[model samples]
Target: MGRSSLLKRIFALNVAAFVLAGLVLAFTPATVSAEIARLEAAVLVLVLAATAAIDFLLLRRALAPLRRLSGLMETVEPLHPGQRLPEEDSSPEEIRRLAVAFNGMLARLEEERRRSVERSLGAQEAERLRVAQELHDGIGQSLTALMLQIDRAARRVPQENPLQGELCGAREAARTLLGEVREVATRLRPEALDDLGLANALEALCARVGDQSGIPVRLSVDPGLPPLSPEAELVVFRIAQEALSNTLRHADASAAELTLAVGDDGTVTLRAADDGRGLGDSVPGAGIQGMHERALLLGGTCQLRTLPAGGTEVALRLRTAEVVA
Candidate 1:
C-alpha cells in the first residue's frame, strides 16, 4: 500500500486506542484509574506489533517483481542474444511495462553491437591489405633492385680488392632483408587465404613459423571440412596467427599443435596448445586481448588456460551459420 494509506491506518489505530482508554476510565471508579491506564497501554502495544507485521509482508510482496527481474537479467548472455523478461497480463502492471521497455532496449543494443563489430572487422581487414600491398610493391621491389645493382658492382670490382669483400657483405645483407620483407608481407595478408582456403592457409602459417623459430608446429584439420564465410575465416586465421606468435615468442615452447574441427551442426573449434612454460602468473597482452575480441565479434568464446600437462592452450569456438552444404 502507498505511504498515505499506511499513515491513515496508523491514525485510525491511535484514535481507537484513545476511545478504548476513555471507555475503560468511564466504566471504572477513580480508585482504579492507574490499573485502567496500564490496560490501555497494553492494548496499544499489541496493535503496534500487528501493524508492523502487516507492513513487513506488504513491502516484501511489492518488491518481489524486482527480485524476479534481477534473476532474469542474470541469465541473459550477450553471445546468444534475444533473452528477455516475461511481460504477461498476470504480472504487475508496472513491472510488465518495465520488462517490455527493457526488452526493446536490449534488441536495439544487440543490433547496434553487431553492426559495430562488422564495421570494425571490415576496417581491420582493409588496413591489413593496404599494408601488405605497400610492403610487397614498395619496399620489396626497391630492395630487390638494390641487391641487383650491388651484385653488378661487386662483379666489376677486382677479386683481390679489399672493397670486394665489403660489397659481398652488403649484397648478402640486402638479400636477407628482401626475404624478411616478403615474409612480413605474407604474414600481413596471406594470398593463400583466398586461393587455397582456410585449412591450407593455416598449414602454410604453421610451417613458416616452425621454420623460422626452430620449433615444431603440428597442424591437423578435419578432412572435407566445410568452408566458412570470408569474415569468419579471417577471424579464425588471425586467432591462430596470434596464438602461434605468442607461443613462438614467449612460451619457451619446443613444440606446438594447431587443431581445427568442424562439427556436424556447423560449429567450428580451433585450438592451439604448446609444450612449454605456461602463462606462469603473467598478465595477458595485446595478442590475447585481440584474439578474444575477434572471437566475441563472431558470437564465439576464447578460452586461455594452463594445460594440465604443463603449458598454455588457446581454445576458441564459434557457432557460425555460414557453413557450406
Candidate 2:
C-alpha cells in the first residue's frame, strides 16, 4: 500500500476524533430536545468551542515545521549556497523527508552551478591566451619591424635633413605603441603566473598597478604556502586584480595592500584593502559580482565590505580540502 499523505492523515485524525465524540455523547445521559434550556445550550456552545480550539492547536503544531521550512526557502540566495532546513526528530515523517529532499536538491544545484561557471571561465581564459599570443607574436612583431625600418631610414638621411626629425618621431611613436601592445597582452594573459609562480605574479601585479595608477601598493605573501591548483590560483589573482582596479577607479585611494596567506587549517586567503573613501550605500557593480562568481567556481567565498576606520576590503577564502582542483 502507498504511504499516507499529510492531508489524508489529518483528515483521518479529525474524522476519528469527531466519531469518538459522537459515540461518547450518544452513550451519555445528555439529551437534545426540541426546546433546550438556556444553561444546557450555553454548555453545548462551550463544548463545541473547546473542540474547535483543540483542533486548531493540533493543526498549527503539525504545520509549524513546514512553515519554518518555507520561511528559509524564501530567504535563501541562489548565488550563496549552504542553506538547509533542519530535520528534527520531533518533526513529522513527511516534514523530515521533505527537508532531506530539499537539502539534496540544493547540493545538486550548487554542484551544477559550479560546473557551469568552470566551463564558462575556462573558455574565457582560453580566449584570453589566444588573443594575447596573437598580439605578442603578430602585431607586436610587425611593430618591431616597422621601428627598425624607421631607425635605418633615419640613419640614412642626413643629420640636418628635416625628414630625419620626422623619421625619429615616427620611430618613437612605434616604440610607444609596441610598449602599449605588450602591456595589453600581459594584462590579458599574465606570463608571470606561468613563469614565476603565483607569489611573483602577485608582486609584479602590485608593482604594475602602482606604476599605472600612481598609487602605492604593498604586497605580502606567506612563506611556504600550500600548493593551489592552476584554476584556484587564477581565481585568486583575478579577484585581487579586480579589487585593485575598483580601488584605482572609484575608491580615490592613495594606497592599497594585498596579502596572501594560508590558515592553520590549510585554507588559503587573499585580501586586498585600500585606504580610500569607503563604499557608502553604493551597490556592488559587475566587477564585484564577477569576483564573487569566480570565488564560487572554486568553492570559495569572496566578501567585500567597508572598513570601520576607512577604505574598503575584499577578502577571498578557499578551503584547500574542498577545492575541485
**Highest-scoring model, lDDT:** 2
Q: How close is candidate 2 to the true structure, as a TM-score?
A: 0.90
Question: Whole-model lDDT for model 2 versus the true structure?
Answer: 0.86
Model 1, 1-325: lDDT tens digits are: 3223333444565565566555645665423444567766666566556656655565666567768887898888776566788876566566677789989998999889878877987898899899999999999999999999999999999999999999999999999999998898899898889999899999999999999999999999988567788878888899999999999888899999999997787778899999999998999887887787788777788999999999899998888574342
Q: What range of 10 consecutive residues in model 1 has the weakest lDDT sum?
A: 1-10
Q: lDDT tens digits, residues 42-112, model 2?
A: 76676667667777777776677689888877887987787777876666679778888988999999999
- Model 2, stretches more than 4 Å misplaced? 1-12, 27-29, 33-46, 323-325
Task: Name the Cα RMSD for model 2.
Answer: 3.1
Would you give me the overall lDDT of model 1?
A: 0.82
Score each candidate by Cα lDDT: 0.82, 0.86
TM per candidate: 0.79, 0.90
